[model samples]
Target: MIKQILPSEVVAVDVREDPPEATLFPEEEALVAAAVEKRRREFRTVRHCARLALAELDVPPSPLLRGERGAPIWPAGIVGSMTHCAGYRAAAVGRSEVVSTIGIDAEPHDRLPDGVLDAVSLPAERVRHAALAGADATVHWDRILFSAKESVYKAWFPLTGRWLGFEDADITIDAEAGAFQARLLVPGDTAEGLYLTGFAGRWLVQDGVVTTAIAVLR
Candidate 1:
């Protein structure tokens, strides 16, 4: 399902069920030792999807840890992202030499909690959402808008190592094309000597889930 939105250079794996073989490393286990069963299950299953994606690139299985901001620390030369929602887990990875960053997120296909839409979105974005919703009332534009910002932040953080507030980027969605663009209100310089001003990504709504992804190539 996630692969439908990503480019061919990326390896995307998603699962609707928790695999029995999805075991966690001791380090990863320790991080979620005190959490409830649901937390543990999602965490373990998502890493399993990540490992499977990594293996496709000939990368050996290893402990996938987290760096600052809780982003998954991928194997060297790899850029990736992971997301899990009710009844779904997904991971997407790519060679860093070809892809600078990757961001992916999934959410249940439903409206945002009351006030969440205003909190996470800029006024212009909200106006756009209204226009979109008016055109096609079947889709949950607010949820997809939130997911797009999440993907934008996920793609932004690994390079800048900074926090991206929900209000930091303005998202524009193209409902017909199943695509979106995030224009950064606060641009930053990356370690790779690139100044990121915006990101273009794709979105999908299917089988009761909404997914968004961004992959920036070098």
Candidate 2:
């Protein structure tokens, strides 16, 4: 489902429920050695999906450690992201020669809890969501926008080593196009000679989940 939204060079794996078990590498086990059962399960499940994605690229599975901000550390020559939520887990990867960075996120297709949307969105974005909500009533536009912002932050942090607040990027979602564009309100960078003031990504809402992704070319 998410593959349709990403570039052809990227490979992805997704599972509806946690796998029965995952064989974690020694280093990876230490990362979650003290975690609760549920946390360990989620971590292992997403990592399992990631290894499958790496295998698709003909790269052998390796230990994926967590960075300072809890982002997955992919092997050299690879760029990827992993996400998991209730009933869903997914991973996406691409070769660095073709992709400078990639970020993917999945969220339950439901309204933001109470006032959570206000915290995650700009006033203008909320207005846009209102109009969209009335038209395409099938998808949760607010949640999708939130997911897009997450993708933006994940991709941006890996490049700039800077924090991107929820309000730092103004996102515009085009439901008809099944895409969104995030215009950076802060400083941007050049990826592979392309000056990126913004990132354009694809999104999909399906089977009670919303997935968004961005792949910067190198």
Question: Pick by TM-score: which candidate is best?
Answer: 1
Candidate of highest lDDT? 1
**lDDT of candidates 1 onward, in order:** 0.95, 0.89
Off by over 4 Å in 2: 190-194
Query: Which 10-residue span in candidate 1 carries the lowest summed lDDT?
Result: 187-196
Query: What is the C-alpha lDDT profile of model 1 across 29-68, one tens digit per residue?
Result: 9989999999999999999999999999999999998888
**Candidate 2 structure quality by residue, lDDT tens digits, 62-93:** 89998868877889999999888888999999
Which residue pairs show backbone clashes in model 1?
none
List the candidate 1 regions with Cα displacement exceeding 4 Å: none
TM-score of each: 0.99, 0.95
